[model samples]
Target: MSQGDAQIDFYPATQAPIFRENWPRMRSHAIVPRSKEGWIDPVISEWSLEGAAWEDFHPHAEYNYVLEGELHISVDGEEVVLQVGDSATVPAGKLGRYWAPKFARMLTVYGPNPDGEESTDFKYEEL
Candidate 1:
């Protein structure tokens, strides 16, 4: 490898830093860490859930692809069930709720960081 040369980055995504830390029913394996230099995370993660649910909104967009089982998602109260090999995109600033019954395995992508703006944490509003 030489200075100024582009290098391929490899992640041992299936090993170490194992999932299911605090959120018992939910597990995540991060492919890219959240960015401190953007309004979006620029992150990719593999996630699994069993009988779990969560809700939030972000200033940036979010995408979810189901690899196995099913993922239930609601964007602004419109519900969609993502079956195996299905995907969904939640536009920027919309409230989203994600969950799974039985089990689900999926990949999640966040943001393009188009403007390179500072990121803000997830938000929520009372129903």
Candidate 2:
């Protein structure tokens, strides 16, 4: 997919790649490829973590929607616990930590990506 392609993309919720240690041992799969569409830059992915935690700073705003289990996010000096069907947005540049006590599945969206393909670089970091 590329800019001006203007084609619909369908990625099944259950369609996830092999679990990889992308975030401090947490697993994630990139659902949307890196691309530029006009002035918009977006990243989409499915993530799951169990008994683990990870933290990072995003240069772009991030929206996380819980799909199953629960997710606990600590940002801006507060702990935001999101259960199934819950959603939350972390402001750009905020240090956010995500913790899954037992297990959690989520749909994540990061947008207005200021760094293009590098916007979601955290997913590939060795950390």
Candidate 3:
């Protein structure tokens, strides 16, 4: 497959190099990397972590799927648990946190690149 294809396939148990080697430290990694101007494009992200408290605001909505294990996600004070095979979407403008008492792996899709000119206001909040 040529680079920059609109779609890419991955093997089972395959962790993209960027994520396989740094999942612990980075907790997350995005594949089909996007250029700074590729805001209209979507990116798939793989995340593995024990626990994390995050406050993020984006101009585009985010959709998440639990690849393995489970995640207790809280969005704007609403709590939900996503087990393997489950999915959820956090709309743009919402703030949330994700916690996994045990190690968990998940895949996420953002409607738009999180770091594009259209989303210049995207930032992690202090809360």
Instruction: Please tell me which predicted candidate would have the highest TM-score against the true structure.
Output: 1
lDDT of 3 by residue, 55-120 (tens): 456667878899988777777788999999999988876665666776567898888754563433
Per-residue lDDT tens digits of candidate 1, residues 1-127? 6878978778765732324355566677778766556644368888877777767666777899999898888986699999999999988877788788777888889877656544344332222
lDDT tens digits, residue span 16-78, model 2:
653653444466778875455322656788887777776778777889999999898988789
Model 1 has an lDDT value of: 0.74
Sorted on lDDT, best first, the list reads 2, 1, 3
Candidate 2: segments with Cα more than 4 A from true spot: 1-6, 12-25, 35-41, 117-127
- Model 2: weakest 10-residue lDDT segment is 118-127
lDDT for 122 (candidate 2): 38
Q: Give candidate 1's TM-score.
A: 0.76
Ranking by TM-score: 1, 2, 3
TM per candidate? 0.76, 0.73, 0.67
Residue-pair clashes per prediction, in order, are 0, 0, 0
> Which parts of model 3 have CA positions greater than 4 angstroms off?
1-26, 113-127
What lDDT score belongs to each candidate, Candidate 1 first? 0.74, 0.74, 0.65
